[model samples]
Target: MNWLILVIAGLFEVGFTTCLKLSDNFTNFKWSAGFFICISLSFYLLNKAIQTIPLGTAYAVWTGIGAVGTVLMGIFFYKEPSDFLRLLFIFLLIGSIIGLKIVSE
Candidate 1:
Protein backbone atom coordinates (compact mmCIF):
# COMPACT_ATOMS: atom_id res chain seq x y z
CA MET A 1 0.00 0.00 0.00
CA ASN A 2 2.80 2.36 0.82
CA TRP A 3 4.52 1.45 -2.40
CA LEU A 4 1.31 2.07 -4.29
CA ILE A 5 1.06 5.48 -2.69
CA LEU A 6 4.63 6.18 -3.71
CA VAL A 7 3.80 5.33 -7.31
CA ILE A 8 0.75 7.54 -7.20
CA ALA A 9 2.81 10.30 -5.71
CA GLY A 10 5.30 9.88 -8.53
CA LEU A 11 2.51 10.18 -11.10
CA PHE A 12 1.22 13.28 -9.40
CA GLU A 13 4.72 14.72 -9.40
CA VAL A 14 4.83 14.22 -13.17
CA GLY A 15 1.44 15.84 -13.59
CA PHE A 16 2.37 18.88 -11.53
CA THR A 17 5.68 19.34 -13.35
CA THR A 18 3.91 19.35 -16.70
CA CYS A 19 1.35 21.72 -15.31
CA LEU A 20 4.09 24.01 -14.06
CA LYS A 21 5.52 24.27 -17.57
CA LEU A 22 2.09 24.89 -18.99
CA SER A 23 1.46 27.58 -16.43
CA ASP A 24 3.56 30.05 -18.42
CA ASN A 25 5.31 31.40 -15.36
CA PHE A 26 2.06 31.52 -13.41
CA THR A 27 0.42 33.88 -15.85
CA ASN A 28 -1.96 31.19 -16.97
CA PHE A 29 -4.57 31.08 -14.26
CA LYS A 30 -6.00 27.65 -14.93
CA TRP A 31 -2.66 25.97 -15.39
CA SER A 32 -1.26 27.68 -12.33
CA ALA A 33 -4.16 26.50 -10.19
CA GLY A 34 -3.80 22.96 -11.43
CA PHE A 35 -0.09 23.09 -10.87
CA PHE A 36 -0.37 24.16 -7.26
CA ILE A 37 -3.14 21.70 -6.50
CA CYS A 38 -1.26 18.83 -8.03
CA ILE A 39 1.93 19.85 -6.30
CA SER A 40 0.25 19.92 -2.91
CA LEU A 41 -1.28 16.54 -3.50
CA SER A 42 2.00 15.13 -4.71
CA PHE A 43 3.81 16.23 -1.58
CA TYR A 44 1.08 14.96 0.68
CA LEU A 45 1.26 11.56 -0.90
CA LEU A 46 5.01 11.62 -0.87
CA ASN A 47 5.01 12.21 2.85
CA LYS A 48 2.74 9.22 3.30
CA ALA A 49 4.94 7.08 1.11
CA ILE A 50 8.12 8.03 2.87
CA GLN A 51 6.76 6.57 6.10
CA THR A 52 7.89 3.18 4.82
CA ILE A 53 10.40 3.95 2.09
CA PRO A 54 13.66 5.57 2.99
CA LEU A 55 13.66 9.32 2.46
CA GLY A 56 16.60 9.32 0.07
CA THR A 57 15.24 6.48 -2.03
CA ALA A 58 11.71 7.83 -2.15
CA TYR A 59 12.85 11.31 -3.08
CA ALA A 60 15.12 10.03 -5.83
CA VAL A 61 12.38 7.90 -7.32
CA TRP A 62 9.85 10.67 -7.11
CA THR A 63 12.08 13.24 -8.78
CA GLY A 64 13.26 10.77 -11.42
CA ILE A 65 9.71 9.91 -12.40
CA GLY A 66 8.71 13.53 -12.49
CA ALA A 67 11.73 14.56 -14.53
CA VAL A 68 11.31 11.86 -17.17
CA GLY A 69 7.56 12.19 -17.36
CA THR A 70 7.72 15.96 -17.68
CA VAL A 71 10.29 15.75 -20.45
CA LEU A 72 8.19 13.25 -22.36
CA MET A 73 5.16 15.49 -21.98
CA GLY A 74 7.14 18.40 -23.31
CA ILE A 75 8.37 16.44 -26.28
CA PHE A 76 4.97 15.05 -27.25
CA PHE A 77 2.44 17.67 -26.25
CA TYR A 78 4.48 20.86 -26.43
CA LYS A 79 6.42 19.70 -29.50
CA GLU A 80 9.76 20.26 -27.84
CA PRO A 81 12.97 18.88 -29.26
CA SER A 82 12.62 15.47 -30.89
CA ASP A 83 16.27 14.82 -31.56
CA PHE A 84 17.44 11.22 -31.40
CA LEU A 85 20.16 12.04 -28.94
CA ARG A 86 17.68 13.75 -26.66
CA LEU A 87 15.44 10.72 -26.81
CA LEU A 88 18.39 8.46 -26.07
CA PHE A 89 19.13 10.54 -23.04
CA ILE A 90 15.54 10.26 -21.92
CA PHE A 91 15.82 6.51 -22.26
CA LEU A 92 18.95 6.58 -20.16
CA LEU A 93 17.11 8.53 -17.52
CA ILE A 94 14.35 5.97 -17.57
CA GLY A 95 16.87 3.18 -17.17
CA SER A 96 18.49 4.95 -14.24
CA ILE A 97 15.13 5.44 -12.60
CA ILE A 98 14.35 1.76 -12.95
CA GLY A 99 17.72 0.86 -11.52
CA LEU A 100 17.01 3.06 -8.55
CA LYS A 101 13.71 1.35 -7.91
CA ILE A 102 15.29 -2.08 -8.16
CA VAL A 103 18.10 -1.27 -5.80
CA SER A 104 15.71 0.39 -3.41
CA GLU A 105 13.79 -2.82 -3.06
Candidate 2:
Protein backbone atom coordinates (compact mmCIF):
# COMPACT_ATOMS: atom_id res chain seq x y z
CA MET A 1 0.00 0.00 0.00
CA ASN A 2 1.00 3.61 -0.42
CA TRP A 3 0.84 4.16 3.28
CA LEU A 4 3.31 1.39 3.88
CA ILE A 5 5.64 2.86 1.30
CA LEU A 6 5.37 6.23 2.92
CA VAL A 7 6.18 4.73 6.28
CA ILE A 8 9.23 3.01 4.83
CA ALA A 9 10.33 6.26 3.28
CA GLY A 10 10.02 8.00 6.60
CA LEU A 11 12.14 5.26 8.19
CA PHE A 12 14.79 5.90 5.58
CA GLU A 13 14.65 9.54 6.54
CA VAL A 14 15.60 8.46 10.04
CA GLY A 15 18.41 6.35 8.61
CA PHE A 16 19.72 9.28 6.63
CA THR A 17 19.63 11.54 9.65
CA THR A 18 21.59 9.00 11.68
CA CYS A 19 24.12 8.57 8.94
CA LEU A 20 24.44 12.31 8.60
CA LYS A 21 25.44 12.56 12.24
CA LEU A 22 27.86 9.70 11.89
CA SER A 23 29.36 11.13 8.72
CA ASP A 24 31.20 13.89 10.66
CA ASN A 25 30.85 16.49 7.95
CA PHE A 26 31.20 13.84 5.28
CA THR A 27 34.75 13.09 6.34
CA ASN A 28 33.85 9.48 7.08
CA PHE A 29 33.51 7.67 3.79
CA LYS A 30 31.38 4.78 5.04
CA TRP A 31 28.85 6.85 6.90
CA SER A 32 28.80 9.48 4.21
CA ALA A 33 28.02 6.86 1.65
CA GLY A 34 25.33 5.52 3.92
CA PHE A 35 23.85 8.98 4.25
CA PHE A 36 23.69 9.42 0.49
CA ILE A 37 22.17 6.03 -0.07
CA CYS A 38 19.56 6.42 2.60
CA ILE A 39 18.64 9.94 1.49
CA SER A 40 18.32 8.84 -2.12
CA LEU A 41 16.09 5.94 -1.25
CA SER A 42 14.03 8.05 1.07
CA PHE A 43 13.43 10.65 -1.61
CA TYR A 44 12.61 8.07 -4.24
CA LEU A 45 10.09 6.38 -2.01
CA LEU A 46 8.59 9.70 -0.98
CA ASN A 47 8.16 10.59 -4.62
CA LYS A 48 6.36 7.36 -5.22
CA ALA A 49 4.12 7.88 -2.22
CA ILE A 50 3.18 11.43 -3.15
CA GLN A 51 1.79 10.34 -6.48
CA THR A 52 -1.42 9.33 -4.72
CA ILE A 53 -1.28 10.86 -1.25
CA PRO A 54 -1.91 14.53 -0.63
CA LEU A 55 1.24 16.59 -0.53
CA GLY A 56 0.58 18.30 2.77
CA THR A 57 -0.47 15.10 4.46
CA ALA A 58 2.47 13.10 3.14
CA TYR A 59 4.93 15.81 4.03
CA ALA A 60 3.60 16.17 7.53
CA VAL A 61 3.57 12.44 8.15
CA TRP A 62 7.00 11.97 6.66
CA THR A 63 8.59 14.70 8.75
CA GLY A 64 6.69 13.60 11.80
CA ILE A 65 8.04 10.09 11.52
CA GLY A 66 11.55 11.35 10.92
CA ALA A 67 11.40 13.69 13.89
CA VAL A 68 10.10 11.10 16.31
CA GLY A 69 12.45 8.41 15.08
CA THR A 70 15.52 10.62 15.18
CA VAL A 71 14.72 11.77 18.69
CA LEU A 72 14.30 8.20 19.88
CA MET A 73 17.48 7.10 18.17
CA GLY A 74 19.41 9.93 19.77
CA ILE A 75 18.02 9.12 23.16
CA PHE A 76 18.75 5.42 22.93
CA PHE A 77 22.04 5.33 21.08
CA TYR A 78 23.66 8.71 21.54
CA LYS A 79 22.59 9.09 25.18
CA GLU A 80 20.78 12.32 24.43
CA PRO A 81 18.67 13.85 27.13
CA SER A 82 15.30 12.14 27.74
CA ASP A 83 13.52 14.55 29.98
CA PHE A 84 9.77 14.40 30.65
CA LEU A 85 8.87 17.38 28.49
CA ARG A 86 10.80 15.98 25.55
CA LEU A 87 9.11 12.64 25.91
CA LEU A 88 5.72 14.24 26.28
CA PHE A 89 6.17 16.18 23.07
CA ILE A 90 7.35 13.09 21.25
CA PHE A 91 4.23 11.27 22.35
CA LEU A 92 2.12 14.19 21.22
CA LEU A 93 3.82 14.15 17.85
CA ILE A 94 3.17 10.44 17.56
CA GLY A 95 -0.48 10.94 18.32
CA SER A 96 -0.69 13.63 15.70
CA ILE A 97 0.89 11.33 13.14
CA ILE A 98 -1.58 8.59 13.96
CA GLY A 99 -4.46 11.02 13.77
CA LEU A 100 -3.30 12.18 10.40
CA LYS A 101 -3.12 8.61 9.21
CA ILE A 102 -6.63 7.93 10.37
CA VAL A 103 -8.09 11.07 8.84
CA SER A 104 -6.25 10.89 5.53
CA GLU A 105 -7.84 9.22 2.57
Task: Indicate which candidate wins on TM-score.
Answer: 2
**Pairs clashing in candidate 2?**
none
Evaluate residue 72 in candidate 1 and report its C-alpha lDDT on the 0 to 100 scale.
Answer: 85
Quantify all predictions' global Cα lDDT against the true fold: 0.87, 0.97
Tell me the TM-score of each prediction against the true structure: 0.88, 0.99
Model 2, which residues run further than 4 Å from truth?
Answer: none
Q: Mark the regions of model 1 whose C-alpha exceeds 4 Å error after superposition.
A: none
Please tell me which predicted candidate would have the highest lDDT against the true structure.
Answer: 2
Q: What is the lDDT of candidate 1?
A: 0.87
What are the per-residue Cα lDDT tens digits for candidate 2 across 1-105? 989999999999999999999999999999999999999999999999999999899999999999999999999999999999999999999999999999999
The per-candidate count of clashes, in order, stands at: 0, 0
lDDT of 1 by residue, 41-103 (tens): 999999999998899988888888888888888888988998999889989988987787788
